[model samples]
Target: MMKALLATVLAVTPVATVTRLSLPPPTGPAKVGVVTAHLVDRSRPDPWVATERFRELMVSVWYPARSVRGHQRADWVTPGVAARINTPDSGFTLPVTHGHLNAPAAAGKHPVILWSPGFGMERTSGTALAEDLASHGYVVVTVDHTHDAQFVEFPDGRIATNAIPPVATPAEEEQLIGKALDVRVTDTRFVLDRLRTMPLARHMDLSRVGMFGHSMGGAAAAGTMLADRRIRAGLNLDGSFAGPVLEAGLDRPFLLLGSESHDGEQDETWTRMWDNLRGKRYRMELDGSAHLSFSDFQVLLPQLGLPPDQVEPAVGTIDGPRSVAIQRAYVRAFFDRHLRHRDGRLLDRPSPRYPEIRFP
Candidate 1:
């Protein structure tokens, strides 16, 4: 029943990437928790324009907390967005919050999920999905890929503006893809390792883990599954396949949830990845959905007074309620099935209840 209450109001896009200024106020008996760490891309160099000290990131881990009532919730973003409009290279500062006010803190080990946002998108782009997962008792670790994301905010007043990587040229796209695979997989693997040692995160259930992403983030999800055997399964939300993932020929349980543009015969990457799945594999397409459909922006656009055409027409096909509900159901089902080893009809087959979801 817990969902992103203010999801409709949080808008993030290619044009305007303002971040959360404060954590969502708590609610219910369930509490919330969050932590962030900087990750070096290793593959890219900071552009000349980037501040030398602002090259690193701060990635947050959100979960249901136990006793967040007394603790102060972090801001959703830094306070400078309004005043720093002239700073073209600034990042969004986010607050680390416990669950809604009066919400109960989660106890014991729960499932764990590693999250990746789309290309050129910060980890917060998938906040709606991430927060919902956290509310459902998953330790959601959202990775902030340095030099790739716009910016990542830290607990302190400091912010890390995205260090521009080597300019991505047409000729370098393939190399960038390869580098992305390395960056995503290594960063996730390190976090999993570090989580075991984190004094604060000692309660996590490391064995129960899954990976997911949107757009290029989706591709990174598949890449993580291939690179790490510790991951039980993976899910991709409308990301194309390339890089070493296809070359390796994936052999684990994976899901490809795509948009309308990516479901056709011309988009062979989706089909090729589908063909290469050696374990359980499923594909679903949302009618009229676009590349950005998987992100929360779909719901935030109308609330921001944006025109209908501002979002891809295909993305508009997915109404907010149905879209968010479907995302919650399927994502929870995927992680629930593999991480918890539970049986769920949501992942069993195409259902009449979710008429909007077309399984191919």
Candidate 2:
């Protein structure tokens, strides 16, 4: 994760003038529809906020929609969440998304892909990927882990910031992150349970479930797969596994797509997990990408006028559109192959179109 880089950049960079931005349109055929839900897991107490008796979550479900003609498009982040993260003077308005709000789901059952964002990042940070997957006939659930997310805006107007206990030492830091990952795994399972009861549930094929995440979320994806058999395949974008996931290993289909700095040879955790994999697995490195390149930051940062020096270190040297395209292709290819039983030869070998992708 680019945690250090983000902190450094945020601390030193001067706030710019406010400019409105829009997410790149999804490349798939279907128009995307999104709905937000407030889910509560009464079975468990929140690990981060002990004062709370139940674990509450805000989740957005993106799926193939009938049309985007009259429905209102969704905001990238709720005004409250955006205000909490960005200063008023810092020309950082949340981007407008391509998804229509509460549109009717398209007919027929579709595979499901659960998404989690980086630590202290909002679930909407994965909106680009979710929209892309929804356009391609998959129902993607993006969860905002209350307290862990930078800010979760509930329907009732309550906003929750990350409440994980602070650590004074590196060991305590690891422990805190480990506990956060555990909470994320539990959150994902609860979201899955709630999805089965939704009106849109009839259009979702839960049996073909998959999960993918960026940074800490990616770590959670691997951990969730190990903990839940419902996740038939998992993808990790620039994240290293921890705790039981790193120790117990995984036997299901998993994909490790990372930035250049932490490829298979560079990261021992990746090597260990790769070797322990018992089912179909693939590992790839995007040559020009950095940790945040797999995130919406790849596009958002540049639009905000962050210089190449600052953006490139955290994201990558690749053009934002190209980065998004490459990620969308590879991610969908993996899911299409494993969950839908389609031929994903794209995963079998490197493609000339994306010379930036390296397989080891």
Candidate 3:
């Protein structure tokens, strides 16, 4: 779920002075371009906010750019989303990103990777990973599940927020999460269908599509793969299986990348899901990382001057840059081997470069 406000407060021991925050530059050779589209799913009603007539979504597409020389950089979070996430008294300013906004897509049909952020989190929470993949010649599509996300700003200036209320019991929590997962799965499939007919379709190799998500988003990735045959591979970052995939099993390539606190051994859900995998599968854990380390929060939270203790429980004990580097490397490797038909030796064994990572 979007970083829990209560959890953030409980995790942080001492709040530090606010300072300038910035995301690291994309590590690939090519420049990145981003474009946002506002879509409405007429077939479905708003799942969380029942008052809405239809399900509206905001999706950001990041891709390799023809040139970044004259393009404008995008904001890490749009003004509307930032407003909803930050209080008037909060001293934090959202970071500026490195993506060239609305720049022309680079020539070539590149493989696609669809990304979904955690529950209540903005789509931009996955921007770092998306931009990295885009820079490496992948067309990355990140979706903001309207009414499920903390805030989704549409082109017409409407802002949608998570309307699902807090749950009081475990059963209630599970029911809410299950409903959210169903909506996420549908949102993903709808986005893919729309992408296939958009102008960007010319530059996307849809047949080679893959998906990865953080926290609840990761769980949605698994469910999406089960529901949509278009997704050839799926990766879950610190998310547990909460859907039918746990019993039905998956027949395509799947990877489980988790933090020290939860892996195949530590979490029964992971073990159960791992056992159900019927196709090519791999599981690995980052020794010092936490649930949010696989997300942009690994860097963003630290830059916001949140004390290490406050961030560590959620993002883990790993240094922000190191965590991001390991994620970028491994995620790229997984997709490369599965989608691009490349040999990603890094996934085959333990590597000296990231000794903190362990295979199970």
Candidate 4:
């Protein structure tokens, strides 16, 4: 009867082509611990109004917990932010997720995964990746770099919108990337410190931790790993290269997953990082995926009924399900190999199951 029931569940759910790691239909019964922190940096200069304070950021931490019997799930994003992301007829709006809301006392000692989202996107925008990692037994902390992101929503309903940065030109994209990376690295390091001192998180395995992100977040993860040795491993989910990450040489285990447009085992930026990596390194390219494919936008796009051509494809992207699955497998495998010391064949070679991915 148990086997039959499991089979039925699998048959009804949408199975990812990669790894055959089928996920049950998305639901909200699990409770994820969440906390919002305000971080102020003195080194960053406010380009918008010429403020001395470098930057301020709002960060949210999501982790698996033992109980959620009465906890209210957190909103995917604030209503106002959702409206903007899901503009009328834009087909980017996601279904309301009652994810774990503000619950301070419900903390756990799970390993951590620091997430950074794409350019001009909110921290919560990577809900798909965040929630997935949390479900698989990692505490995921995401930060919204005040001016870089659209808006950051905290548990108290305090919303921080993008403060006008002094510089907002395309030429300064790299500058914004650096500023955002600065905020992310600080936020992550602070959180790590806070966790070490937290009496509630005594059970968390501080020694085992990783970082992963899409787009700019991906770049930040690389940069952070180089700066902080606390990070055991890192994964870049289709983010473009940036800053010293390319030049600094990564000595830790890292994985770079790219979309068709950016996938290159020998690209200049990646090649340099590859050459610098003194530890384990792996690279995989998803032919059909695009920049937006790294986030929840992949799953949300189809739900909104937007044709593939309308959304991220103007820049060359893949469909949502495939993109999400590819990410799900590579990330899980990477973490498993490094954090758990598990031998997952998925990381060793390309699988016939997901032919869309190529590893050189």
Candidate 5:
């Protein structure tokens, strides 16, 4: 999301213009810990390649940490991944993530939550939400689909970048994006199957799993729920559904948290999904938010010193910090209600604490 802005500004904005920006701190009290695994699925071949017979993925697990001291802080993205988005020549740096490197997982099991980022967007883009969920005693995992993420750096020092091409027509757009969603559904399910084998398995209660994503990833969240029964609840952040997920609505709880312009009147996919839905649901719109506001760009992009005209279109007119708070609170509420069996008041109606949310 900040790619074009960084390229434009770095050209005329001068060198050594670095601002170390931080993701908003989680509201929960527990300290966060994170560890990553390089997972390979021998059952599926590389979706975007022919030479490879196995699909490879990079997965990060975040959980409540027993102790974060004496460990190095994790970078938002790996150095190799950062070089693709934030140019090294500009001397700019992303903030260290709230998670400490491979800190010990807190005692006892916690409900698991899986995150899928927007299409062609890296898994790191959802760090704010993932970290926040982890702090609240949830074992949250984020996945980077090789060849679909901005870039994925394997343990072997191999970097796989996005290879999806541009399309000209809506038909072509649907065909390409539909294919991507199919791959993401398998990716989501594959990650869930492998979660129990990770070191954090003792802290992960996969029985109470919930899933969510931004943009196309959000749509895939629903698709995966349909394909896999293990996913008990799902939510979509400012995204429209594709494929059978659009028509074959879920019986399990599903929440739609969308931006100002993403309504049933504007997008038929949402309308169909809402009408087809048989379980608990809420179609929420953040008044001042744009599509990207639902992602980390809501807070991260403003620090880049882009032109105001450029910034507004990306994250929207809402206060960046305010948007982040609203998203973090409501998202947690929905998951808490569905995954943990807690009664959620935030999803019941528009609260004064967050006036920007509307039920449509």
Candidate 6:
């Protein structure tokens, strides 16, 4: 929902003078390696457009690499996705990722985690978190829901842009978002199915699978977990809930993370979601964060050097590096506790190490 909403809004803002942007380094010991695959779901026809007969998706699979000494650094995003994210005229270059391209996977099978980005945002939106997790020995897969994302680039050099249109009313918007969740849920399931049999299947322990997402993608995480038992855990970052998950809460582990302004008090959806949880559930908030702080946008937008007033509307007042650090730490901790059976004690309460994280 944001490429048109935020990207269009961003177009009107004063362009930044900053020429280049770089992501922060990964915090774990293992080297990160990533591979992108173009997937075609012939069983399902394109829902947003009538001309297309099947659904096509672009997916990035990140893993713990044994060695990246000779492999090349991966682009944070494909050139096409980069253009749709930042207007070409802005003259700001996108960041490069720590992921090495097609590097060899580490020896032991690792826990698998799937990532879904915010509405209208590409999979690259969660690059910082994915890389950090992979560096910690998790198999992190990021999915870009075709036609729903701002742009998706495939291996054949073809690009697919968003096909969904704006809605005119709140009722219509709600229905459209539900439909996006429908697509996202199905996309996630299909990706999980493919991953179980892919070449990297040897590197993944499918039984230890988890999912997380930001914004609409966050809702999809809950939605997908509800629809599939294969996913052992789920997390939602500052996203509201809609559809069946609201009524049929999950029995598995789940965590709801929110920014300062997004809470059960403000969003009734969060309250309903909290009430229906039947299993282990935890909720937390980031004190100085905003909706976008849960994403890579937290790291990139600040470099724009927008007026202080303008900053709050986008990524919030929190410093860029601090936001990334908090997210990488907490998100990693949740998965480590639930998926790896490694409780790092960071999630038990607010840690002095990350003062911005609150148990609200």
Best by lDDT: 6
After superposition, candidate 3 runs with Cα above 4 Å error? 1-18, 86-89
User: Against the true structure, what is every candidate's RMSD?
Assistant: 6.3, 1.8, 2.2, 9.2, 2.1, 1.7
Write the residue-wise lDDT of candidate 4 on 1-360 in tens digits. 212221221223232321211222222334555655665556555543465455556667776656656667766766766665444444232354434565443344567777877666778767766766666667777877665565666456666655535556877866765766776666667656666554446646788989888777788888889889999999987776777777777888999888776744435677677777788989888886666667665665444333445555522456566666667777877897899888867887889988888886
In candidate 1, clashing pairs total 32
Worst 10 residues of 1 by lDDT: 1-10
Measured against the true structure, the TM-scores of the candidates, in listed sequence, are: 0.80, 0.95, 0.94, 0.79, 0.95, 0.96
Per-residue lDDT of candidate 5, residues 48-161 (tens digit) = 887889999998899999999998889998877666656656555677899989988899999999999887778888999999999999988998978877689988878997
Which candidate do you rate higher for lDDT, 1 or 5? 5
Q: What tens digits encode model 3's per-residue C-alpha lDDT throughout 77-153?
A: 88776665555445565678879998888898999999998877778888888999999999999999887776678
Q: How far does residue 157 in candidate 6 sit from its true spot (Å)?
A: 2.0
- Give the poorly placed runs of model 6, Cα more than 4 Å off: 8-18, 83-88
lDDT of each: 0.67, 0.86, 0.85, 0.66, 0.86, 0.88
Report residue 165 deviation for candidate 6 (angstroms): 2.4
The count of backbone overlaps in candidate 4 is 8
Worst 10 residues of 3 by lDDT: 6-15
TM-score winner, 1 or 3: 3
lDDT of predicted model 5 = 0.86
Query: Which 10 successive residues of model 6 have the least lDDT summed?
Result: 8-17
Q: Which stretches of candidate 1 lie over 4 Å from their true place?
A: 1-29, 38-55, 72-74, 80-105, 164-169, 264-266
Winning model by TM-score: 6
